[model samples]
Target: MKFSVFLDLIISGAFVLAAFLWYLASSDNAKTRREKGDDESITKAEIFKSWIIIILLCILGLGYFFSFIGSLSL
Candidate 1:
């Protein structure tokens, strides 16, 4: 509820959103590569990398959000 906590969530959400968009782009690239018989696995790897980072960022962001919210409760 505080300004800092809200800002933190916004930043975290930004990172998460970026990662998701990257994943989509990577998926499209992978599809294209597959169609062209290019490096299909590389695209898959990039998607996995982005997804993992997104998940980790979300976990950290949520942890921060909840901690701030918890502080407000007291």
Candidate 2:
């Protein structure tokens, strides 16, 4: 594989990993908030936003990874 293609795969993998970690963090934060009975905690809108970000990141990462796979085949 070319250096650039390898780099792209690495970046895409990073993006996917970041998204997964972000999701886990968000879930843990919500659980902590619930357990603590915090008066001021993450709102529904914030949760929704986080989910959106996670989804977008996954989409971007997968898109790049698949495109690179195709290129490598050529």
Candidate 3:
């Protein structure tokens, strides 16, 4: 395969892995909050931050996919 294709695969895989790890971390954080009875503001902040990162990751992944498609020969 071409170098571009290989590089794209690597980057895409990295993005997928990063998103999955982020999800796991967020899940753990929520569990910790529940167990510790964290403040409402803290919980809200964590949720907001996690959502923003997840949304950004989704957008970046979609953008990369479209760009890869555009680069294809057919």
Give the winner by TM-score: 2
Candidate 3 clashes between residue pairs 3 or more apart in a chain or in different chains: none
Candidate 1's residue-wise lDDT over 1-74, tens digit each? 56875776666677667767766776787788789887767767876886787678677767766766666677
| lDDT measured at residue 28 in model 1 versus the true structure, 0 to 100 | 80
Residues 1-74 of candidate 2: C-alpha lDDT, one tens digit per residue:
57997877888999999999999998888777778876553555567888999999999899989978987998
Candidate 3 weakest ten by summed lDDT:
5-14
Task: State the C-alpha lDDT per candidate.
Answer: 0.71, 0.85, 0.76
| Model 2 spans > 4 angstroms off | 39-42
Model 2 poorest 10 in a row by lDDT:
38-47
In candidate 3, how many Å is residue 7 off? 1.6
Total backbone clashes of candidate 3, pairs 3 or more residues apart or in separate chains: 0
Cα TM-score per model: 0.63, 0.83, 0.82
In candidate 1, the residue pairs with backbone N, CA or C atoms under 3 Å apart (3 or more residues apart, or in different chains) clash, namely none
Q: At residue 69, what lDDT does model 1 achieve?
A: 68
Model 3, span 1-74: residue lDDT tens: 47786566567667767777897899789889978998968887897898788878867776776666666754
Q: State, as a TM-score between 0 and 1, how close model 2 is to the true structure.
A: 0.83
